[model samples]
Target: MDVTKKKVLNGYHVIFLVQNVMIGMSLLSLNNSLSAVGYSQWWFPILFGIIANITLIPMVWLSLQYKDDDLFDIHEKLLGKWIGKFLNTFLIIYAVVLFSAIIQHYLDLIQISVLPERKITGHLILFILLTVFIVKGGIKSLARFCILTFFLMGWIVYFLRWGIMYGEVSHLLPLFNFSSSEFWEAFRNGYNSMIGYEFLMFFFPYIIHPQKAFKHASIGIWITILFYLSVTIVGAMYFSEWQLENLFFPILKLFQAVDLTFVERIDTFGITIWVFLILTTAGAYLWMAKKGIDSVREKNSNYHIYAVAIFTYIIINLPFTQVMKETLYEKDFYVSYGLILWPTVLCIVHLVRWKKKEVV
Candidate 1:
């Protein structure tokens, strides 16, 4: 594929791509994670958005330094062939695992709520196939799909009105009562919900207007932060502290509070519509993993996408206990945190080298 032709993402695509990827399965459990801070946890999303934007600085700076290169190219430039290739391999695996974990979480929900008797393998195969199809269309297709995804499921916010109406307003009054330790604990727990934006490094080269990409991406982050804040506030207000801590999917409970004349299973409907968001998230990561493969090979091909989809499917269906799956899922956050911060180190190294050359 021609490199120039492949760079198809515009500013709006950049905006929605970040937004859709960030709003994934993690939102269902985010309030539970933030329960450590009590009512004040509503502010965590804002804090997270601010922090995400700040970290995005080095990522954007690094990408702009080499406008035609992705993260892998920048890694190789900064660290040379052997070491950069090794680290890129680690990143590819990380992307694959991240994809598998998202698919695994959603499939688990399907088994528990939608199909108790069906084999998880069946669902896993179907979902991975769909992901592969989306990725086959390339990142531009995925970005356009994200625009559709934003509209398809964005109405979910209106459902929060029920939760807000039923919830105790007094619970929201004490905004900053939590101790620093408690706030840190909550931030640690819920920060994973904000991990998807770190992908900006890989996709930056695809943006048509690289200079304005940061503003578009920032809009996406704050948009997601608003959604997270709305849901977290509603969850904090409606659920007791114990309930907020114990409930696995607080968003589902919020939907349950919706009393619709025609639909008794609105929560199920919400879960169904949520598949769009899941596909958008997993598709982006899967695409990134494929791109990593191309980076390693120095060629662009869709075959790697299929191979990765198959690998991820097998990993998802491995005969591991639920405990093991959850453990693996939890471990991805550590990798994500490291990946988000790694570009800062790269940016510093690049600057030091530039200064040394100037001095010489």
Candidate 2:
């Protein structure tokens, strides 16, 4: 269908899509994840941002090579059909698992914090329906939704001022205090927050200004980095080392610092609003998974979206043990990290093919 010709996503869409996707469930617990470095964790998002930008270069470079082809199509062209399809199967699985993981994690948090008395089944069903609706509209629709989510949810950052006002500035001192092992531990644990930027590989074909995409996407990333940095710095300043280490979602604790008259339980309010971020993140993955299914079957159909959504629903609802679920959702991020780096391998393949063509 030459989907690239239908590119409707502008630079702002690219920016917001990159930003919102990276801002999902992870932000809530990001401080906890980076607790290995103690107070020094405030700058970790910057480190993550730097790594994300470096990795971003290869992805954008590869996408520029085939302006009309997404990562799935690029795989087929570069590696040949059978091998590419084999690799794409794993990509599809990665997308589905990631979509399921983000949804499950958010729903679980809601159960713990807001709807503890209620079973998550209702929440799960509602979330899937909303996600399916967003993905069904396709990438342009999803991009618009991402833009809306960014504006709507971006205001919540203002609430962090309460924590900043009350927190001690001295907590940010003793910089670089962590050992080398601790830095590595913090990096490993917190890198998941940076995962969404890689989806740029999947959507690059739809960008209206592909050349400016790197600039726009970089802006989006730094915006998220600044947001994360603000929250982490406030968290470091506001909480004790024990709280930073033990509180599962320190941002929620930061939320408790809000002493407003009209708003009671602002944390719960924040969690409720978080559904928008979750929707955009899951919607992007679901859309990519649907595209993967279409590429595999060599047909375009709305049913692909539904099929992936159903599969995601079942995967999340499965009665796996807590440990098993954690392993699948948390530990399986190696697939995402691999996807981020996969473009470098493809770039090498591209150069070889170019040389061979020249020799011919």
Candidate 3:
């Protein structure tokens, strides 16, 4: 591999990459999703941040062990080629399904919240084409795009102050009143917002500073946590318990509170600008799927990228009922939980094998 083409990501790119990936469409629904815990739900994002940090350790450790390989290659190294190929195929499918789900959910939101007349297939086609363009330039290009997305979409946070001003401080009271079941339910419901950080496992080899990767990645995760925490807190304060439970995209409702005289219906603009965040997310997954294909073939080619992108494009465009689509997307949450545990299991396997070899 050419040096120019490989090992190009620095610390901040890694940081922003993780941050942008973690903060996606899920941020909009997160407050509503966690409303099960009511006023105390503000702290759930902090819990997610802690979990994100912990799950990240095994992934980072495993990647540092094979500095040149992504998780797909690491899977083959840790398992025999045949078993690894099987698992890798499954992982590729997971990536494509995940990509489809994210795109579908985002497009659905756009259709419902912003652009009602446009065909979903039209939006998906344009989105996937743009994503393929980014993915084709390879991971470095994708990382740079993520950086751009962070700067572009991040200012939306400033709008939260409007929600805060209209919010009642009393809604934030009785913060610890939730039971364990409510907390667990809220945690599970909100965990999907934290899903994208695991993409780090697949892109770790590109990081120039693997030794400090954890620190930088943690910073990114914390940045996401800060945004999530702020939004959740503001949302808790802003919406009544019943309103929080009912609003599908609480962030959009938050945007509605903004008193911008020049731009009426700011959420319409928010959804339009939010395309970058969705692109960053869907592009990352598409790249990972492409990488998995390349790993299986033992070579790199743009054909794999196009194939996966097309597959994803088709998957989302399929005429599944809304109920079916929701079910499929819901399944991804469990699949993601499995992906998080996967690294820790692999690390344990590696450690055991090393120990036996040392003893021998």
Identify the leading candidate in terms of lDDT.
Answer: 2
RMSD of 1: 1.4
lDDT of 2 by residue, 1-360 (tens): 223337878999999999999888989999999999999999899889999999999999999999999999999999999999998888899899999989989998999999988998888989999998888777989988998998888888898888889999999998899999999999988998898999998889889889998999999999999999998999999988899899999999889889999999999999999999999999989988988988999988888888998898889878889789989987567788888888999999999999999999
Cα lDDT for residue 54, model 2? 93
Model 3 TM-score relative to the real fold: 0.97
The candidate that wins on TM-score is 2
lDDT of 3 at 175: 74
Give the candidate order by descending lDDT. Answer: 2, 1, 3
lDDT (tens digit, per residue) of candidate 1 on 83-126? 98998999999899999999989988988887887887877888
In model 1, the Cα lDDT at residue 282 comes to 97
Point out where model 2 deviates above 4 Å.
1-5
Whole-model lDDT for model 3 versus the true structure?
0.87
C-alpha lDDT values of all predictions = 0.88, 0.90, 0.87
lDDT per residue, candidate 3, 71-118, as tens digits? 888888888798898899999988889888888888888898887777
